[model samples]
Target: MRVLVTGVTGFLGYHIAKDLLKDGHEVINFSRRHTSEVDELGIETIKGDLTNYEDIKNALRDIDAVFHAAGKVGMWGKSKDFHRINVDGTKNLVNAMKEQGAKYLIYTSTPSVVFGKDEIKNGDESLPYPKKYLNEYAKSKSIAERFVLESNGHGILTTSIRPHLIYGERDKNIIPRLIQRAKSGRLKIIGDGQNLVDINYVENASHAHVMALKELSTEAKNQGKAYFIGQEKPVNLWDFINKILEAKGEKPISSKVSLKIVYFIGLIFELVYKLLGKYDDQPPMTRFVALQMGTSHYFKHDNARVDFGYSPKITIEESLEKIKN
Candidate 1:
């Protein structure tokens, strides 16, 4: 298969590309930025923007399947920018895929799409999109995931994989951010410090993408559906953070803050930033972050397992070893 991996410059997308190459597929990358990984992997790449329909159409010319892993991800950003990159970008991809007759599309979605005002435990793909999203990233991603799923069939098979709290080698977010704050002594346990959540090691998350790509097709059970993939077990959120901090040789976070106070502080930060017109700046305690840190959001991957034989290839113990090395 000639596979085109979008966002090969990104952390997860790069890993997905590597997995496809390992499987002896001819892999092409479609990304706006040129990175050493692409050059190092020696995969053919088409430099283009996702918002540009022409670029996506051209990128799909000879591609058999696409691992659409590109998107604007953030807790704070200009809503318009997120929409342009995540929503409009996906629209262009879906339309271009149809026009180019690309057979399969596997979107890299998020569990945040279903996140709302309440905490979710053991949530499944059956959970519907929230009535209101906590942040621009979730809103835009929800829209994009919907586009990818609804655009299924009509000669194009499509599905979305939602992975949560991903961390591991070459990680640009999540773990890195935690380590920075922990080392700086600014990290604190939000709420009760007992919330459980799903964490996906990078390799495990990327393998889920590979599994989806392999199983997606016409008449396939995975077609047009979304699946949540993560470690087989959920971990205590703060305990997990402490493990990473320990591996990085930093003291664990001991301070604690109430979710209500943090949420209020976040509201104030948001107002100040908005008034100052700093849409690109992220507030330290945004409502979204407060909810995420304070709530339990583990998911059930039974559907992913049943549909495409998905499972975490790396355990938390293995992940800690990788970080220590």
Candidate 2:
């Protein structure tokens, strides 16, 4: 099979492309910039933007499957920007897939799409999208997921995989930022430190994408559906952070702040940032970040497993050990 993976420079994208190559598939990396890593792997490269229909159409040529993993992800961003990249970009991909007769599309989505300022322990795919989104990123992603799933027929097999708190080796965003904040004495527990959350090991998350692509079809159960992919069990959010800190030779986060106070502070920061026209600057905190840290939002993976034989090939212990070393 010939596979096209967008955002191949990203950690998860890189993993997906690598796994495809290992399985004896022709891999084409789609990204705006070239990286030495991709060149060294001898994978074909396509330079393009997801927001451009022609660019995406060109990349879709001779592609049997696609992993649409590119998006602007963050707690803070302009609504228009988020919509353009996440929502509009996905629409472009869907159109290109249709134009070129691509059969399978496995979209990378986030569980935050259903976040409604509440705890969601053991949630499943049946959960509805939130009525009010606290962040533009989530809102845009929800719209994008809908577009992808709705464009299911007409010889296109599409499914969305929502992976929570993806982290592991070569993680450029999540854990690295946490460690940086911890080293700067700026990290604090937002709640009572009892919130549970599901996290995806990079390998497992990418493996799920491959499984979905292989099993997806017009008559397949996974077609047009969404599945939550993560570790077999949920872990305490702060406890998992502490484990990573320990691996990095840093002491655990001991300082604590009330969720209510932090949420109020986040609102103030968001307002000030928006007022000052500092779209490029990071907010001190955001309500979405506080809610994510202070609540339990783990999900069950039975749907993914039953639909496509999705399983985490790497254990959490093994993943942590790899990071530790």
Candidate 3:
């Protein structure tokens, strides 16, 4: 199979490209910037932006399937920025698929799209999209995911996989940020630290993408559905962070600030940042970060299991061992 993977330079996209190449598929990597890192893996590279229709169409040419893994991901940004990259980019990809008669589309979505302030304990695909998203990232993802799922059944097999807090070797987001804050002595446990969250290892999350692409069938009832892909078990937030700190030979520090205080502070930051025209980087903390850190949002993968045999291969213990090594 000739597979085209967008965001091939990203953490999860890199793993997906490597795995697909190992599976004996010809992989074409699409990204705004060309990197020798992917070329080192012996995969073809296409330098282009997802929002450009011609770029997407050129990448889609002669491609059998697509792994739509590109998007703007952050806690703070202009809504237009998020919409342009996430929503409009996906629209471009889907339209290109329609024009080129691409066979399959496996969209990489985030579990945060269904999250707000509520405790979404063991929720499934049936859960409604949150009425109000805390940040533009989630809002744009929700809109784009709907487009992917609804774009199915037009001779294009489409499905979305929602992976929560993906982390592993080569991770540039969560661990590095945590280590930076810890080194600066600015790291703190938000809220009571009892909130349970689901995290996915990079390998397991990438495997889910391939599985979804292979298992998407016209007769399968889950064609237009989204699956929650993560480690099967949930871990308490504080305990998880402590494990990471311990692995690094460091002690975990706790914060005593109330959630209300942080949330209010985030609101003030948002207002001031908007008024001051300063939206380039993330705020010290945003309302989205506060809710994500303080609230519990683990998901049920029964649908994934039943539909695509999507059981996660890497356990938390195994992931920790990998990280430790």
Candidate 4:
């Protein structure tokens, strides 16, 4: 099959493209910037922006399926900017897929869409989207994901995979940001650091994407459903970080800050960034960050396993070893 993967230069998209190629599928990568790294892997590359309907439509020509992995992800940003990239961009993609008569669309969503001030323990897809989102990123994703799922029966087979805290080799988000803060002596554990969170390895997360696409069908069970993908076991935030630091021969982080203090500091940062007109990018800390750091948000993957036969292949220990090396 011929597949077009948006955001192929991104962390998860890169792995998904590689996996597709290994499975003997013709892979075409769409991105704003052309990179020789993915090109060297023998993927056909197209430079395009997701927001532009023409660019997206051109890339869909002759494509069998689409993996919509591109998104605007951040804790802080103007609501309009997030809407343009996440919601409006997704609308454009869906419209293009309809015009090109694409068979399947597998959207990569986040579990944050269901998150709020309360803990989300053993939550499933049956749980409704939050009444209010903490940040623009989550709100936009919620809106976009709704469109993707609703477009399932409209001549397009669509499913969404919500992977939480994806981390592994080639990760440029959480791990690197934490290391940078640690080096700057700004790393502080929040809320006693006992919150359990789900972290998905890149390879396993990529495998979930492929499995969802392979399982796509006109059946109601396979159509218009979203699944939460993650490791089999949840890890305590502090324990996981300390283990990684110890394996890397770095000192384990011991200092801590109360959730109240962290929340206060995040409020200050939000106001300061707004006052400074720094809305183009994310602020150092935001309300969403505080909630995520201090709250336990894990999901039940029973639906994914039952609907798509999806199970994580890599163990947490194995993932940690790969990261350590």
Q: What is the C-alpha lDDT profile of model 1 across 37-138, one tens digit per residue?
A: 789998988999999899999999978899999888899989999999999999999899889988999999999999988989988888989888869999
lDDT for position 72 in model 1: 86
Per-residue alpha-carbon lDDT of candidate 3 for residues 126-154, written as tens digits (9 for 90 to 100)? 88998898889999999999999999888
Per-residue lDDT of 322 in model 1: 94
TM-score of each: 0.98, 0.98, 0.97, 0.97
Error of 3 at 208 (Å): 0.8
**lDDT digits (tens) for residues 1-325 of candidate 4:** 8999999889999999999999999999998987877877788789899899999999999988999998888888899999999999999999999999888999999999888778888888998998998788999999999999999879888999999989888889888887777778887788888899888999999999998888894344668989998899888988887776665566678888898888888899999998999998677788789989887888899999988888999998988888984
What pairs collide in candidate 4? none
What's the residue-level lDDT of 211 in candidate 2?
86
lDDT of each: 0.90, 0.91, 0.87, 0.88
Stretch of 10 with least lDDT, candidate 1: 212-221
Candidate 2 weakest ten by summed lDDT:
212-221
Query: Which runs in model 1 stand beyond 4 Å of their true positions?
Result: none
lDDT of candidate 4?
0.88
Inter-residue clash pairs, candidate 2: none
Off by over 4 Å in 2: 217-219
Colliding pairs, model 3: none
